[model samples]
Target chain A: MGLKEYAGKQIEIDDDGFVVNVSDWNEEIAKAIAAENSLTNLNAQHWQVINFMRKKFTEDGDTPSVRALGKLSGVSIKELYELFPKGPAKLAAKIAGVPKPRGCI
Target chain B: MSKEAIERVSIIISKGSLEGVYPGLIMANGARMEGIEANLFFTFFGMDAINKSHYENIKVAAVGNPGLHIPTLLGCIPGMSALITSQMNKTMAKLDIPPIPEFLEMIADSGAGIYACQATVEMFKLKKENFISQLSGIITVGEFYQMAAGGQIVFT
Candidate 1:
């Protein structure tokens, strides 16, 4: 389930396709994962959401919910789907190198 | 990616207050977050949650709500409900919880099935136009119960 090829760079990922090591993630890895999910051309809006989630995960030890993302990420819920599609919290958290959000489902 | 362990969850939204509406929304979105399919059944006063016009303005049900920890007598005081709602909203903002409408939009976009109860719509004379666009459509109890078969069911 690894999409490790980022311009020939390799990194291990979990079975759910989330990067296993947070530190292994960088701009290239994030871009690769985003494109793999059919979200190409990571824009300022994309990076803003990703960076905010990463920062939140670092401080709170958990990723915020879709509700939280919609509120604090400077992106509306409708726009989030336009950017990440289906599940923005899950997709963005995976790209941002965070665990699946706790108690979500 | 390996398959997620849980597949489907059906949640019932039965209360109209802000507090009640959100738990269902949060849980439904949570299920989608985990790659689990989700269905929401809006019934009784809960139908207010799906009303395009009313849902946006839902407020905390402060009076007679034990969760608010306001004594019944104090809760009757003037402006108490609004004050409590204002405080709750501030804390929710700090926690980054979206308002009811945004949460509903997130839920729908996550592929969660939103079903309004058949009986309630008829009882309230609610037309299809009264509902938000995301509803899978109004459904009978028999249909919803069948859809909920073999899946976890939550009542809110």
Candidate 2:
């Protein structure tokens, strides 16, 4: 784990660059993470997914899988790939300050 | 550790059994989840995995299988294969693993290429409509090799 500054706060992040403490998350931090992932624009659709992920983690104690995100996140599977490019679920979870979803799809 | 990562993979699915088809699907899906390019080539009995009428009805091979620990003769009994298949399906469902058709859709949507073998399609006298909608196309082995260039090839 490493400590990094985002939005003027020193936050701890894991080896995968995901925040170690979910409580440390904020909209500014999310935008910083998104920019690091080359997503410079956090548009409405992007916030929808980020909010959905954070809400699910708060309610379920775990991040949703790509399949779950596709089915319930108001984002289609093809569009999820378009939004996150490489790995949608993992990247979104990282930006959303949640643990990566486990298991193979 | 080697600095080079696997950028792409071409998986060959040649077995028709339920066990045979899932490994390739899982691998292809896993690759996409990791941002790796993946391709699936369905040939021989494996065509059943992509075949519209057969994809959903794939059964476990109960006979001549030592993994079940049941007598081979017992496996030959009527309804044994179906029983095992249903039980396996239940276990898979509990694990959140989708059935074949849905799995194919997921893999396809994940940006992996799903292709059918031209030779097998011809041998079975099948058309494009015989396979699932997720199929990228029917391709020859030569074309598969062309696509597999610069990538690893795995036979499942």
Candidate 3:
């Protein structure tokens, strides 16, 4: 509910495909992510990634597990992390352009 | 320059280094920023940047670069490419600039004209899917020249 609690929540997915809760989400962050990834369609996969990313960020105050994500997405771990500099939660949430998770900024 | 203009700037991109790649990317991106109609025709080694498989895996060769004197033995090591590329990419990232694929995607999404040379496409046996999905189409040199005739041109 508050910024501290929000930051502590899981906002993104780890490299291992585990849920990472995010405490907050915002608009500028969303647009920046969307623009960075050039995501054309915010389909189910996008949501899955975005939601997980936010959760991961909230829970850890860091981006999801990059190496683990590569194993999960089938994209080279190197390539996957490179695609999202700010990590999945921020990028996915940005692309979805949704409100930050329940309690995030 | 408009489609109807006769005098245009033209640029030919033929290198594939991180530095080499910059000429084409910077020129094209800069051209679009200036409201000039720019056409990027990727051929030979330059095609690596747009080739779907190599887009994200692009690397800079240290040997024979005329800039770096890295030993050939060291140059051949695994992970070296990733190390060099990550550094280049990270610098670009810090500047808030997107990678080549992302930049191309944004430009293509914005309606700028992009073409993979037919000769090169055939040389590499590249298909439409080999390049990013946003390309308008593969075109011949004749067609590329037609567009090049009226715009500013630079060769990287």
- What value does the lDDT take at residue A55 in candidate 3? 57
Better of 1 and 2 by TM-score: 2
Could you tell me the C-alpha RMSD of candidate 1 in Å? 5.0
Worst 10 residues of 2 chain B by lDDT: B27-36
Interface RMSD of each: 3.4, 0.9, 13.4
Give each model a TM-score: 0.71, 0.96, 0.54
Question: Tens digits of per-residue lDDT for model 1 on B97-141?
Answer: 767776777788777889999999999999999999988989999
The digit string of per-residue lDDT tens for model 3 on A66-95 reads: 322333444442343344433433344344
Docking class of 2: medium
User: What stretches of model 2 exceed 4 Å from their correct place?
Assistant: none
What are the RMSDs of all candidates, in order?
5.0, 1.2, 12.1
Question: B115-135 in candidate 2: lDDT tens per residue?
Answer: 999998999999998888889
Please rank every candidate by lDDT, starting with the best. 2, 1, 3
lDDT of model 2 at residue B140?
A: 94
Query: Mind giving the per-residue lDDT tens digits that candidate 3 earns over B1-156?
Result: 656632334556676767777667766654543335567777788888788888777677756654656777776788876787788788777655667777776445333567788998898888998888877778898988788774566777
Give the Cα error of residue B126 in candidate 1, in Å: 1.8
Runs in model 1 deviating more than 4 A are A1-21, A26-87, A95-105, B1-4
Least accurate 10 contiguous residues by lDDT in model 3 chain B: B29-38
Lowest-sum lDDT 10-residue window in model 1 chain B: B93-102
Q: Which residue runs of candidate 3 sit more than 4 Å off their true CA positions?
A: A1-105, B1-8
Give the top-scoring candidate (DockQ).
Answer: 2
